[model samples]
Target: MKVLITGAAGFIGHALIKQLSATAEHVVGIDNINDYYDVELKHARLRDLEGIGNFTFIRADLVDAEVLNQIFATHRFDCVINLAAQAGVRYSLDNPKAYVQSNVVGFLNILEACRNFAVPKLLYASSSSVYGLSKDVPFSTRQSVDCPISLYAATKKANELMAHTYSHLYGIQTIGLRFFTVYGPWGRPDMAMFKFTKAILEGKPIDVYNHGQLSRDFTYIDDIISGVMRLLEKDGLEANSVFNIGHGSPVSLMDFIRAVESATGMTANCNYLPMQPGDVEQTWADTQGLFDAVGYTPSVKVAEGAARFVEWYRAYYKI
Candidate 1:
């Protein structure tokens, strides 16, 4: 099947492309390659995909409707996975416009293109942050996520609403996967796992936000991709569906730090700090909706995932 995957240079996007390539599926990937984090890392991800199976990469921004329209017309994809967005909670606090431009405008362009082009299905990225300050232990797709604490979370919620409207009106099969804290090799540098690992390696102090009192449902990259592939294969189920793609287990911040320390064989210098704005205390996903649809279950633990990431970091940086 022909597929169009946005944010090709991103962590999840890159991993998804690699998985899709192995199946000999023709994938046309696009990314603006903005300097949200490390541009070199993004380039490296693209370099890795070069000449891999039937994968094709296009350096373009999703906000540009003309470019997106042209690509949609050219590719005529069976599935369009819109993973492109400005992804960060704290970053959205300082730079709110960036979130609107990328997450809001970019996603609207995708929905419009899909509606006009008659694409069969759309698999877009949502976040567990949409749950906001909910007192719920494990977040379910059925829960009301109207009270978003951050602009980032608000935009993700908007994406869900937009996708649902299109699905209802135009008969497009839209699946919004509310991803929990996804971490593994090729993970984002801003994420806690990557930041802690880097700080430990550099002998710098790792900032423990909320005084290390937080818990996260850290799902492995392999499990995320597996669930995505299953959903892609089984498209056109419900008109509009939302699923929580996460490991049901929520790991504590201190335990997660200990796991990192064990993986790198170096202790992190913990510097406790107050919780930053737009940050939540905990996040745990109830992935029963995903399991019912795709029989998805996470297999990787934080310890093993951290070790694998450390190995990759050491090799990639020649440490």
Candidate 2:
């Protein structure tokens, strides 16, 4: 199968492409390689995929409609996976335009291309942040995600709505995976997992948001890839569907820090801080819907996942 995966250099996108290419699928990946965190890290991800025979990488921004359209025209991909977006809740507070341009305008271009090209299946990444401000434990796809606290969450919620419209109007099978706190090797540096690990290793105090009161589902990257692969391989899914791809077990901020410390064999100096803007106290996902459809659920626990990430971090940095 010929597949097109956007955000090729991203945490999830990089891992997904590696797995798909290993299966001998002709996978084309595209990324703008924006200086959101570290451009060299993004380059490193692309470099790692260099020797794969079935993989191809293109450097392009999603908002460039002409380039994206040309790609669709040339490839006529059997499946399109749209993983590109302006991520981070706190970053969205100061730079709301980035979220609108990348998540809103860029996504519109992707939907248009899929509609015009008549692509049969399109799977896109959504986020657990969409469940903002709802006291709802184990946020399910059935619940109303009408109230979003951050511009980031608002854009993701908008993606689901836009996808539903296209699926109804154009008969495209659109699947939205609401990923929860995805982390592991090649994880984004802006995320808690990477940040905490970096600080702890360097003997710096790790900032604990919400005064150390936050909790997250903390789904591992490998399990996320497995879930996505299951959906891609399965047939006859609903034309418009969204699933909460998560570990289904929420890990507390303190517990997560402890796991990091255990993995690194160093105590973390915690710096307690009030909640930042566009941040939530907790995120828990009801993954039953995903399991029902894909026959898979995220299985990695935080302790094991943290150890694996630290191992990679040490080796990659030669720390």
Candidate 3:
């Protein structure tokens, strides 16, 4: 199968390219390589795929409709895994237009291109943050996600809706994977795991959000890639479906910090603080839909995942 992956320089995107390129799939990846975090890290992710098989990298943005159409016209893709978007929940509070341009407008472009190109499968990235402020223990797709606290979450929910519209109108097979806090090696720097690891090693204080009371279903990156690959290969799923991809178990913020400490062999200087706006108290993903569909079971525990991430960080930075 020929697959086109947006945000190819991103955390999960890079991992997916690595995984799929190892198989029989021909992979094409594109990224705007924005300065949302560190562009160097994004470049580093691309550098990791230098000698991979049948993997082509294109530096581009999803917001550009003309370029997208040209690419689609040039290469007929069997499937498109749309991961390009203005990520970061808190960042959305400051620059909501980024979400609008990248998430909403950009996603529309993807849907249109897929429809025009007759692409069969369209899998996209959603977020557990869509279940904002809900008191639900484990966030499920069956539950209503009409309420989203941040613009980022709203855009993600909108992506799900947009994909559904495309599916209903054009008969495209669309699946939205609402990912929880995904953490592992080659993870995003803005995420908790990376930030905590960096700060701990630098002997700097880490901000314990919600006074260390918040919890998250920290799914490992390998588990995430596995679930995605399984879904990509399977058939018989509804034309438009959504699934939660995460570790079923939730870990407290403090516990996560301790795991990083154990991994780095250094104690963190903790600074407890109130929860920031657009932040949820806790998030737990009910991946039963994924498991029932593809036997997608998360294998890595938080402690082990944290340790692996720390090891990668040390090696990457020579710290």
Candidate 4:
């Protein structure tokens, strides 16, 4: 099958493309490669995919309708996976426009292209942050995600709404994967795992947000890819559906830090701080719905996942 995956250079996008390219007849990946973190890291990911024969990479922004439309016209992809977006909850507090432009307008463009091109399936990345300040223990797709604390979360919730509209109006099978705290090798530097690892290795203090009270369903990248692959290959899914793709087990901030320390063989100098704006106290996903549909569940525990990430970090940085 011919597949188009946006946000090709992103942590999840890059990893997804690597696995998808192995079986897909043709895989086209596109990324704006914005300087959200390190451009070199994004470039490094693209360089790693260079040996893949069936993979093609493009540097483009989702907001550029002309370029995106032309791409759809040329490729006429069998499936379109929209993973591109402005990430980070704290970043959104200061730069709300980035969230709207990339998450809202960009997604709208993607939906339009799918509608015009008659693409059968469009699976896009949503976020657990959409759950916001809800008292729900394990965030489920069935709960109301009406109250979003961050602009980023708000945008993601908006994406789901827009997707439902398109699915109803155009008969496109739109699947929104509400990703939990995804981490592992080639993970985004903005995330907690990467930041903690870097600081611990550098002998710098790591910021323990919410006074070390946060917890997350830190799903490994491999498990996330497996879930996405299942959704891609599975048949008879609802035309408009959303699933919480997560590990279903939440790891506390202190426990996560301990995992990092165990992996790196170094103690993390944690600087306790109050919760930052647009941050949540915890995130735990109820992945039963995803398992019922895809027969998949995230298996990597934080300890194992953190070890793998540290190994990669040490090897990649030669430290």
Candidate 5:
């Protein structure tokens, strides 16, 4: 199958593209190369896929309809794995327009391309943040996610809705994967793991949000890639069906911080602060739908994953 994966420069995107290119029949990637994070990190990820034979890369923004249209016409991708979007919940509060531009308008272009080109399935990134302020312990796909705390979460929910509309009206197959806190080597600098690692290495203090009382379903990058590949193998079922791609384990912020500190052989000076307005106190995924559909299971334990990530972080950053 000819597959087109968006956000090829991102952490998850790089892993997904590499895994699929190595294992699957054919794969093509696209990214706008935005400077939301360090563009160098993005390019570095692309460099990793440099010599792989089955992988192809295209540099363009998803919001550019002309480029999207031309590429869709050129590739005629059988399946589209969209991981592109302007990320960061806190950043969304400062610039809500970026969220709408990338998550909503960008997604619309892709959906239209899928309909026009007759693409079969679209596996896109949704977020656990959409379950904002809900009292639910373990987030289920069937749970209500109407109260989004930030523009970022709101746009992610909008993407799911947009995909569903295309699916219902155009008979397109759409699957939205509600990703938990995804992390590992090749992760974005904006993520907690990456930031904490960098700060600890430089002997800087790290901000402890929710006063270290928060919990997150921290998923390893390998686990996330595995779930995505499995979902791609299966056909899309309904218009608005969302699946949680996670380990079904929620780790406390302090516990997670300790793991990071242990992996790097350094102690962190944390400054406790109130939970930000746009942030959720906890996030845990109910992976029943993913397992039922794709037999999804995560193998990496949080501690072990952190160690591996630290090792990679040290090597990659030359620390």
Candidate 6:
């Protein structure tokens, strides 16, 4: 089957594409390769995908509806997995415009193309930040995500609303996956896991935001890929569904740091500080709905995941 995987050079996107390649499916990948992190890292991901047959890479912004529709016209994609977006909650503070352009306008174009082309399942990335300082533990899809702390989160929440509109109007099946703190090899540099690992390995101090009190549902890349693959192939899912795709177990910031330290066998000098703006204190995913629907259960522990990431990071960075 031919599939259009947007953000195909990204962290989770790269992992998903590798899985797709194994099946010998025709996959058309798109990415703007913005300098949100290192462009080199994005290219490296594309290079890896290039080695596989039946994969096409297109570097373009999603806001270009003409280009987006053009791709839709050229390829009859069985499904379109939209993963591209302006990421990072804190970075949204400085570049709110980026969030609007990529997350809102770009998403509108995607919904429009899906409406016109009638792609089957549209799986887009959503964020836990939509909960917005909510004290509720294990955030569920049933609860309203009306408040968003960052512009990034607001755009993601907006995407869910937009998808619902199209799903209702055009009879398109769209699934929004509210991903937690996803991290592993080839992960974004802005994420805490990548930053901490890099800093600790270089004998530098890593920032402990909120005095190391923050907790996150740290999911491994492999577990996430498994969930996505199953979700993609599994038919007869409810239309206009939103699922929390994450490792249910949340890890404290300190505990996470300790795991990273263990992974690299290096003690980190932490620069403990107050939390930054647009930062959430904790995030836990209530994935029972997803589990019931698709038998989704994350099996990777944080320690093992961290160690695996360190191994990949060391080999990739030659450090």
Model 2, 18-84: lDDT tens per residue?
8998774589999999988999999999998889988889899999999999999998998999999
lDDT of each: 0.94, 0.94, 0.94, 0.95, 0.90, 0.90
Q: Worst lDDT window (10 residues) for model 1?
A: 18-27
Global CA lDDT computed for model 2: 0.94
TM-score of each: 0.99, 0.99, 0.99, 0.99, 0.98, 0.98
Instruction: Report the lDDT tens digits of candidate 1 across residue range 1-319.
Output: 8999999999999999999887746899999999999999999999988888698899899899999999999989989999999999999988999999999999999999998899989999999999999988799899899999999999999999999999999999999989999999999999988999999999999999999999999999999999999999984479899999999999999999999999999988999999999899999999888898989989999999999999999988899
Instruction: Give the C-alpha miss distance for residue 293 in model 3, angstroms.
Output: 0.4
Q: Per-residue lDDT for 65 in model 6?
A: 92
C-alpha positional error of residue 264 in candidate 4 after TM-score superposition, expressed in Å: 0.5
Number of colliding residue pairs in each model: 0, 0, 0, 0, 0, 0
User: Where's the lowest-lDDT run of ten residues in candidate 5?
Assistant: 232-241
lDDT of 5: 0.90
lDDT by residue for model 3 over 1-319, one digit each (tens)? 8999999999999999999997746899999999999999999999999999699998988999999999998889999999999999999999999999999999999999999999999999999989999997788899999999999999999999999999999999999999999999999999999999999999999999889989999999999999999999999999999999999999988888999999999999999999899999999999899999999988999889988999899899988
Model 5 ranges with Cα > 4 A deviation: none
lDDT of 4 by residue, 160-224 (tens): 99999999999999999999999999999999899999999999999998899989999999999
TM-score for candidate 2: 0.99
Worst 10 residues of 6 by lDDT: 19-28
**Global fold similarity of model 1 (TM-score):** 0.99
How many backbone overlaps does candidate 3 show? 0
